[model samples]
Target: MHDSCSSPQTCTKEQVVASAAPERTRPEEGHPLLEPVSAGEVRAEHVLRDTFGFAAFRPWQEEAIEAVLHGPGRVLVVAPTGGGKSLTYQVPALCLEGTTIVISPLVALMEDQCRALAARGIPATFLASTIEQGERNERERGLLAGAYKLVYLAPERLASEWLVNQLARIDVSLLAIDEAHCIAHWGHDFRPDYLRIGDLVARLKPKRVLACTATATPDVRREILERLGFTQGDYAEVLRGFARPNLHLHALRLQPCDQIADAQVVRAEV
Candidate 1:
């Protein structure tokens, strides 16, 4: 069941949680998250507070979110870890009319996010080899029935024609590629499967596409955008510099006896 509140601003966290569970079904609420926002109706503050329980968006997050909702659906967000990059697409996923598919690299990452979203009273799930076959079947059923707002999948999943065909049957509102820097050849951890994403986007033609990463050099950024089918006029790029003053680096070298003494001292302090 979706939240009864038609107005997102007035919607409560309780309402969000109550409507998020997949096991329950209700007649009043048409969807679990809430009714999709009408054109020009999505407000960043409303989504931040009501859906995500945040008072506001982070510095550059608001700009990226606004672009996804109002401007071109193609966006690239380059913000460091802990910068709320997930919220950029997650917020819009709730506001949009259909499911949002996030292409992630790691099963653990997908599972972690899915669990977090579920805890927040958001309908989110992930597909991976770790899931039991029976549970996977149930999730697939839920997906086709529009039970979730966000679904996380691995980039390699794009190689399956069966999966792609199944996805084509649904109304995919947003396609988010996390760790998008991996799409570029020069990226630190490049994957060949990522090269297939641009073609997948072309075939699915989801309403919007969001690429996110914490680290991407200028050349890598360009390569990523090009691979994701973003021409000059087709996308918006939100690049925020990474500057963490709190992080400090120090180095220490010690002989075996000195190291043992230091370890003993630390253990005694603990």
Candidate 2:
């Protein structure tokens, strides 16, 4: 994985891993992370420390979190992999009043994040086809009861009228769209179900929405904003530079027949 340092603070890979570890005690009802700040107030640093056990924010993470927590509430975050893009919304999710709905494209990614949050003593769950109906029902009950801070679902799951109706009943504090580039037709990865997310937002009327992606060009970003029903000046945008000094790229030119010989020679040398 590539290491990214967009902020002047310079965060190391060790620091990032250490922050994500579930070593800190979970924030309780009286903890600072659980305390609600007034409108236009920013308590992200508190959440970063008390919940994630991080000493600082990476690049635009704090700004993005503040936007969702106190600003326009519509945000688009474009940061490279390992740039703490998840924390932009996750931090705000902890401070918000209701459950945060995350629409992710990959089940494994959702499962991994849910597990990580659970390990940190944060309530999180996901809806996936691999789960049995009994478990799904139980999870749904938990969702309605506000037993979770974050609830993940696949983009395709929004197509279900029953599920959408059920979500409408709950107070959705935030709606986060992971891999948001999929909403753009010209993007490298496009999912048709993502196109319906704007409709879902209108139907559910979540108080806030955040779209995050690791790769998106200027045009693709504009398309994503449009797809999510965001007009110019209606949303906040946080973009971290994509320069990875620690990651290097090299290219070698060889004929098709020479490829195996080159690999074998390299392996022998190693």
Best by TM-score: 2
**Per-residue alpha-carbon lDDT of candidate 2 for residues 3-116, written as tens digits (9 for 90 to 100):** 344444223232344332112313231111212247654377887898889999965787787667754566788888887888987888888778999999999999999999
**What TM-score does structure 1 among the candidates reach?**
0.76
- Candidate 1: how large is its RMSD? 12.8
Local accuracy by lDDT, each model: 0.77, 0.77
TM-score of each: 0.76, 0.78
lDDT, residue 231, candidate 1: 52
Over the stretch 1-270, how does candidate 1's per-residue lDDT look in tens digits?
A: 124444322222224455333223232331122123476766668878987789877767887886677654568888878889999989988778789999999999999999989988989999876789899889989999999999998888788888888899999988999999889999999999898898888788665789999999989988987887655233567877666667766556878879988878767965
Off by over 4 Å in 1: 1-42, 249-270
Model 2 quality (TM-score): 0.78
Q: Any residue pairs clashing in model 1, and if so which? A: 2-31
Cα displacement (Å) at residue 18, model 1:
47
